[model samples]
Target: MTQGRSIRLFLVDGAPNGLLTAEIMNWTGHVLTGPRSKLSELVQRPECGRTGIYFLVGTDPDGDLRPLVYIGESDDVATRLKQHNRPEEKGGKDFWEKVCLVTRKDQNLTKAHVKFLESLLIQNAGAMGRCKLSNGTAHEYIGLPESDRADMAFFMEQIRTVLPVLGLDFLRGIGRPSSNQQPEPFTPTQPETYPLAGAENPRLKMEVKKHNIVAFAQELDGEFVVLEGSLARGEWIDLKHNYRHLYKQLCDEGVLVDDGNGFKTFVRDYGFTSPSPAAAVVAGRAANGRFDWKIEATGQSYADWQDQQVSAAAAQSEEMEPT
Candidate 1:
């Protein structure tokens, strides 16, 4: 689990989607984020002149949810951004719509330091398989002094934490667990080990005994988690073509393996953005997880419990308000 930490974000233009800056407590790193339209305004900031690593972000022209991203390090961020902002005929990036850059607030980073950071970031962004990276060149590792390497590694962690807060999750992991995170197994008989607290983010289960479909899931840390070994229907009717492709991709990637029982079983715990998509994967058809995924003990559907929770919170909040 990610340890709790505080992050501070400032709106440079007083608009939520306009030029913005962010910082983490006890961290000496500074982050600058802004939309493509605000490029001129951002270049005026002092951060633009610093040595830093920058990312250019844009939606994929192919309509894939994964956006296109380019990572680069520059001794002068402002100058680099200016070049990218020029018209395509003048060699500017045409695909990027937003930009984020990271630099040291204490002004201690050297060209080597920023190069190391750039190489590492590019490698990770490509490894995540989340977005298409613009850099065609493979990263060339840079050697750093032992102490400096430790410091840079810590700086990268801070960057990882701050990027998600600014709405870029390309660095967020999927499919594989971090080195420190151990995988937990899911077993039907040991259901007690599951997340059990109902009325407060309860664990949910969906099973069609006749179809031999059984799955367990919960929402955690902004993700809908379906545990490992959960059974999924091998054949789904009326499944959208893209969702079908998604399942096949999961299978091809070995996240889901054939169970030899006409079903696909999760080889490891999988997290989905929401229950509906998770349920649809398990059912091999379109599914409403809110109505179909049920609390194992109470037999209440997730939709019912969610309604009750919302109503309760509203009533409690009303009681606390001053008359």
Candidate 2:
């Protein structure tokens, strides 16, 4: 009943000489690191790799101790345990921080003992999936895997089912949900425009088509922006990652007229199909986004607004920075 009391069990098997180890210890006591021997000599070699399970238990401050199980299917059980025992990676986690390495002291573990241990852990681990008992409790089998894929699925399902039975509450850990928080009002930033100035040139001719492919560039308060082409579903894509590359490529092709504000704008005459769905999208967004965007208000198109931004940015940069 002491807070320090806890039990840890391990099912060790690999190639030939496998063993089952279990121990009881205090929460603050030294935890076993890992098995001393290699995995090939531990569990008998199966067709592919090897598999085993580890179980640890410890009392909380209130002296309630329940076993926590970690299952594994691996080529090297000992090596994996060493990784978990280290304090840097998984070792830092609470469940792994106090691992009790287990080994059978009374008798060398046989195949029966390993199977029995696996069944015992599974029965206590969580809800039933499958199992078989052999030799009147000397051996047990749950058809669990010796691979990570099957073992992880089996154990996670068990833990999910058992944690609730242990009376552990996680949702209530933080403050309870509240309904009184007031919604914050949103204020729009500057406007959005298409075909920012220097984005498309007079020489660039676009054909009129049924599909609306409104391409535009704009300048606003000393900013340059450009967008053109059709949207899949009236949606816009953020190309920030490729902005620099796209801009440099465009400039190299003579699509960009100026570069300032740290990032360069597209510099070439990238053509787009005509008719322009962008006009409609920009018009719709104009209701929400910044910019005096309106069919009647600004008497200008989204493409024009974009051009204005670029022109303004170029003009301001020229005025401020001496050549």
Candidate 3:
């Protein structure tokens, strides 16, 4: 089981949407994030003058599944940020709408340290495929001492931990499930047990025989994950719905690629907020996920299986209540 973490978030302007700071317990790294409209306020903060890596986040004009990001490092982040905030005609970036700065509380990071961090961040972001990076080329920096490299690696892990809590999840990679695994059935007696723990969840399948589509998915940590190697329709057939856009985005990101047949294959496991979108992508049209996804072993509809769990939990609760 993963251990719990405590994170502290401070809203600078006393507004949820305004400038905010985040820090994890026992971590030396600090994070400050805010919208582009608050750029002046963010740069004025003392942390901006320290050496650090920063991220520029914005929507992708190409309608990709992921947000667009530009990673960079600077000895004086304020100066670099000011330059980026300039008019586009002045060689400034206009796409970014939010900024997140990662710096150290001890203020001991050097130029080489941040450069090395920037390089790794870019590489990892590309590997995660959760965002479209705007940077042209990633320059490797190997000047850091071995000890310093170890420290930076730990610092990078802290960054990864804190960013997701701050609503930045592009750094998180898709979790791969073990092959041919079947999740244990949810036991109603264990009310406190997490339903989506480990690889115990059932493998669900969505088959559209007419279109030759067959997709496999599982519920993990509350997200519906379409597994790698699942087959989907090559083209979106429903133009009336917005899920077609998501389908197109997945294709553009290479999450779905042509199999040389009439179908598209999942290059990697991808998680959706829920099963409906996953079903929509697989079927090439709008679909009701609860009815569409079925337990591969029992052929039970997802809705029926989920309803059974809920009913069992309720019965368990009633039995536990005072007679």
Candidate 4:
């Protein structure tokens, strides 16, 4: 369980897109954010003179729509930022567009402290798989005193809590079930149903079954999750589509395995950007998942269910209006 956090953000230059400063309630750490265009102005801030860890964030065109980041730490963050902000031809980088740095408000963070923070951060970000890391080397562990280590760990915890609020979430771990967890724990055997928490609504949930093939799907957090044990078509018709690559990647990654019959069976849960793509890869051709999926309990189509939900919401809104 995670406790709540109180983060105070100051929008420097009084604009959201410009420089920004943030700090957690009762925390000694300070976070500063700004665009590369304003790096010169931001570097002048006092926190930039302190030893700290920083992230250079930008998008990677070849990375399948993932953000790219270069993580580094320096005794004088401002000087390092100045060097990086120079042209790539001049011992600088060319990819970053925004900068975010974390430092101690009291300017007491040391090289060893930031080094440990950098190594742990890189490892966790790599595990998250949400971004393309530009860092070519990892920092070796700089062992800290047991007491200072505990304090740094808590500092990292606060950094994690505030990162997502700043529109960065590369450190969030993907949802994965444990090894002993059943693939179809919600429903098993013939006519299996993969129930997801808060997804009981027919409009947003359904199971696809064709002959002996069965699959379950639900929308969560803007992504479609296909539960384990879901069967996919053994072959694909649109080989050039992006979903085809995705299917291949899933198979290569061992998330999907051959069923020994003529279809693909999911060994673990997987997430897709949308329902149609998920259904297409699962059905081996172009498919409209909105119409193909049906509620196991009522046999209602997702499209119809969605219409009913919209109508119900409008009616409720009308009822609540003052006459």
Steric clashes per prediction: 0, 47, 2, 0
**Candidate 2 lDDT (Cα, whole model)?**
0.32
C-alpha lDDT of residue 100 in model 1:
97
Model 4 per-residue lDDT tens digits across residues 1-323: 22577889999899989999999999999999989999889999988888999999997755445678999999999999999988989999888899999999887788999988887778766655567798875766758998887787678778877887898877643333232333331111122122334333333343345545667876643457677788887877786676776677667657689989988898766667677877876777677988877765677887777788899999999999999
lDDT for model 3: 0.86
TM-score of each candidate structure, all chains considered together: 0.78, 0.20, 0.89, 0.72
Lowest summed-lDDT stretch of 10 residues in model 1? Answer: 186-195
Give the 10-residue window scoring lowest on summed lDDT in candidate 3.
185-194
Cα RMSDs of all predictions?
Answer: 6.1, 24.1, 6.4, 6.7
Which candidate leads the pack in TM-score?
Answer: 3
The residue-by-residue lDDT of candidate 1 on 1-323, one tens digit each, is: 33588899999879999998999999999999999999989988999999999999998776555679999999999999999988889999888999998988999999999888887777667655567788986556557887987787678878877998999978755433233445343211221122322245567799877897999877654677787889998866655545776676677667688898888899877668788888888988777888889987798998888888899999999999999
Candidate 4 regions off by >4 Å? 1-4, 61-63, 140-142, 176-213, 217-223, 228-236, 239-323
> Candidate 2 on 10-109: residue-level lDDT in tens?
4454322234333444221111222224323433322112233343332333322222334332334455555654454545223432222323333233
Better of 2 and 4 by TM-score: 4
Q: Sort the predicted structures by lDDT, highest score first.
A: 3, 1, 4, 2
In model 2, where do residues sit more than 4 Å from their true spots? 1-53, 56-68, 71-77, 85-95, 127-323
lDDT of each: 0.79, 0.32, 0.86, 0.75
